[model samples]
Target chain A: MICIKNFLTILVTFFLILSCVLTAQEGKALQEDSKNSLISGSRSLQFRISNNLTLTSFEGAMISAKKHFTSNSALRFGLGLDIRSGQEDYGAVEEDDNLFELELIAQYIYYTSPKAPVNLYLGTGPQFTYNRHVQDRNYEETGEDAAWQYDRSWTIGLLATFGVEWFAIENISFFCEYGASIGYQSRYMESTPYQGYQDQETTQFRLSSQTVDFGLSVYF
Target chain B: MSRLKKSVIAALLLVFGILTGTISGQNDMQTTQDQQPGPQLEHTWSFQAGISEYFTLRNFDMVSLSVKRHFSNKSALRLGTWINFWARETSQSEIKNWDGTNADTEIENRYYFAALSLQYITYLSSGKDVKCYLGIGPRIRFEYWKTTYESKSDALTRLGGDSGEIFAGLQSNLGAEYFFTDNISLIAEYGAILDFWGYSDLYNYKNELSSGFRFSLSPLPVNFGVSIYF
Candidate 1:
C-alpha cells in the first residue's frame, strides 16, 4: 500500500522529464533591454510593504520605510506584527495557544552608486518574539476536563543580512536577502496536577535564520 | 557499469544535454533578435508564490515561493522553498478492551515536511512579455511524523512519539511565465524528482528495530503561482 504512493511519485518524475524533452523547440526569442527602463538612483527615499497575494508569513502585514542619509548610505526601519489564537491538544488534553508577536528592526544600508540601478547592501537589527500557549486534557471515565499546562516564552535576537535590490519598473522593485540571528530566550512552563502542582522553567541561547524575505518596494 | 552506475550516468548525460541545448538556442535567439527591435525585456529579479500538486490526491497541499534572478536574457537562477501540510488529525476515541469494557485511551497523529532547492534555468524562448524555460536543480527535504496516545485518567502519562528523516533529490522541470504587466506575471511549472532517503532505528510506539532506504520517483511535480519581476 505504501509503495503505491511511491509509484505515483515516480510516475510524476517521468512525466516532468518527458515534458521538458518534447518542448525543447517551443520558445521564441531573446528578451532585449528597454532604453526607457526605470533607474534606481532616481528615487531618494522609499516606502515598501508586503506584496504577498497569499498567506506567506506569521505576520499579518509588514511595512518599512527607507531614506537616504548620505550620497551612498541610507537608514530603514521596519515593523511586523501578528496576533492569533493557538491550540495544542494532547489526547486527553486540549489547550489554547494565543500568540502576539511584534518585530521591530532598524538597518543601515550602503548603495553602490548614485545612478546604479542594482544596489548591494548589508543591514543589522534586533527582533523580538513572544508566544503563550495553554493546554488542557480530560479523562473519558470522568467525562470532564482535568489536567492542563501553560507555556510562554520571549526571544530577543540580533540579525544581519546582505543582499541586493533591482528596480525593474517605474516605481516597483524586488529584493532578496539572506541573514542569520543569534539570540537569548527564556521560557516559563507550568503543569497542573504535577505532584499536586509543580512548575518547570527554561532559559537558553540559540542561533536561527534571519532570512528569507522577498519583498516589493513602491518608490516615491 | 552496474545498474546504479548506469542510472547515475544517464542522469548526468540528460542534464548536460538540456543545458547545452538551451545555450545553443540562446545564441540562435540572440542572433535573430539582434536584427530587429523587440520589447525591452530586461527582467533581473522576480518573486513567485504558488500552489502545487494540482493533479494528485493531495492536491493543493503544497505551497511554494521562489526568488529568481536573471543573469542574462537567456539564463537565470532561483532559490526556492516548499512547505507541505497534508497532515490530518482525528479526534481521540475511547480504547475498548476485548471484554467490551472501556480501556480508557485515545490517540492522535500528524505528519509534514519542508524542502529547499537551488535551480539553474535557461530560457528556451524569451520575449518582452513572455518566457519559457527549462531547469534542473538539487533539493533537500526534512520530514517529521508523530503520534500521541493518552490514558483518559492521566494527561501527563500520555505518550507522544516522533520520527524524522532527511532526503536529497535531483529535480528537473519545464515552465513558463507570462507577464501581465512589467512587474506581475502568472507562472506555471511541472517537474520531476528522484528522491533518496535512508534510515535505521525507526520508532514504532515503542522503540523497535527497523531499518530501510528508499529511492522514489514522482511524476507531476506541478506548480501555479503569481510572480512579480523586478
Candidate 2:
C-alpha cells in the first residue's frame, strides 16, 4: 500500500508539471523540429532504477535496451541479477547463508507522440523473476542438533506500463513509468530443525505499482 | 474464437495500424535531425565532491571526490574516489544466570571502506546546458571492520571478531548533468555493478578466507553531486 501511495504522489507531481508546461505554451505552436525526435531504426541503451521512494528501500537496477521498429513503436528487453553469501563461526556456533535472485522483462512499446519533445507511451510485457535463499546452522554443544533451511520462490507475469519520457538533451532522455501485472507465483520452504516445511502456489493480479521506475536512456 | 482471444487479436491489429500510420506520417515530416550539437566544452578539466544517499539526512556514510578531463565534446576520462567510516558503541545491563545478578556489557564496532574507480565516459548527446553520458570502468575497493565486546561480570559472554575484504569489479554508470551555469552542473547517476570480492577474518589468531561475486541488475541513482569545470 505504501508503494502505491508513493507511486501516486509521483504521478500527481508529474501531471502537475506537465499541466504547467502546457499552460505556459497554450497559444504557441510547439516546434516541429525537436532536437530529440525519434525515428525508425533508432536504438537505445537504458539504465532503469526501481524504487519506492520514502516508503521502501531502493529495490535494484535493471539494464535494458530498446530497438525502434518504427518512429512510434519499439521493443525493449531488461535483465537484473543479485547474489550474496556469507559465513560466521564463533566458539560454540557456526552458520552459513546464501541468496540468489534473477529478473527479466520484455516489452513492446507504442509511443503516442514520437515527434514531440515529450513522449507518452504504453507498453505491455512479460516478466519473470526467481529467487532462492539457503542457510545452515551448527551448534558445538553436546546433544545440540544442526539445522538446515531453504526458501525458494518464482513468479512469471504479464505487465502493462504507462510512462512519460522527456528529452533533457539530444540523444538522452529521462523517463518515469508505472506498471500493473497479472501473474502466477510459487513458493517453497523447508527447515530441518523442527521438520517444518511449506509449499504454496497462487495467481496474483496486482494493480498497485510495486516499483516506480525511473530511467535514463542514451539513444544511438 | 473466444471473446478474449478475439479482443486480443483486435488490439494487436489496432496497434499495428497506428504504427503504420505514424511511420508513413513521419516520412512526410522529414527524417529526424542527424546533425550533432555544436562544440560546447572540450579540452577542459572538472572536479566534483559530493555525498551518497544525500536525501537520507543521516550520517555521511559515503563521501566522494572525482576528477574528469574532457578530451573532446564527445568523450572524457574520469577517476573517482569514495570513502566511508562508521562507528557504533552500545552498553547494556542484563541478568545472565538464575541468581539474577546484573551483568554489564559494552560493545564497540568500527567499519572503514574506500574505493577508487577509473572510467571512460562517452557523451551520447549534448545540447545547450543539459547533457547525458555513459561511463563504464573498473573499480578497486577495500573494507575493514572490527567489533569488540567486554562483559566485566561474565568473561564467557564476551565475543566479537574482525574482518577485511578486497574487491575488484566493473561498473557502468548512466547519468545526466544539468548545467546550472557555464562552469557548474548538477549530476545524478545510477550504476550497474559487478564485483568479485575476497574476504579474510581473524579470530583466536586464526585466519579464514572466503570469496564471492555480486551482480546488480537495476538500481536507483544513489550518487548525486555537483561539478565545477575549468
What is residue A122's positional error in candidate 2, in angstroms? 1.8
Q: Kindly list the interface RMSD, in angstroms, of each predicted candidate in the order they appear.
A: 28.1, 19.9
lDDT score for residue A210 of model 2:
51
State the displacement of the C-alpha of residue B58, model 2, in Å, after optimal TM-score superposition.
Answer: 11
Q: Where does candidate 1 chain B have its weakest 10-residue lDDT segment? A: B52-61
Residue range B1-230, candidate 2, lDDT tens digits: 75545544655565567556755776655443334343356998988655334334321113366889999987999887788999999998888676778888888999999988898999876655567788998888999999887877853455778888887778787665767677887665556677666666766333333333343333433455677899
lDDT of 1 by residue, A1-220 (tens): 5556555544565467656755653422112221212333322222222332321221112434565556467666655554444333333444444445566666666656434557677877776777666655555446475766777888887878777777675334566777888889999888876635568788999887764666544343
Clashing pairs in 2: A60-B218, A60-B219, A61-B217, A61-B218, A61-B219, A62-B217, A62-B218
Q: Against the correct fold, how does model 1 do in TM-score? A: 0.35
CA shift of B221, model 1, Å:
21
TM-score chain B for all models.
0.57, 0.56
- Candidate 2 overall Cα lDDT vs. reference? 0.69
Which stretches of candidate 1 lie above 4 Å from their native place? A1-80, A85-97, A137-145, A170-174, A193-197, A207-220, B1-230
lDDT of 2 by residue, A12-130 (tens): 65566556655654533356335564678776766543342211112234456688989899988776677767665554666677888888888999999887778999999888899
The most accurate candidate by lDDT is 2
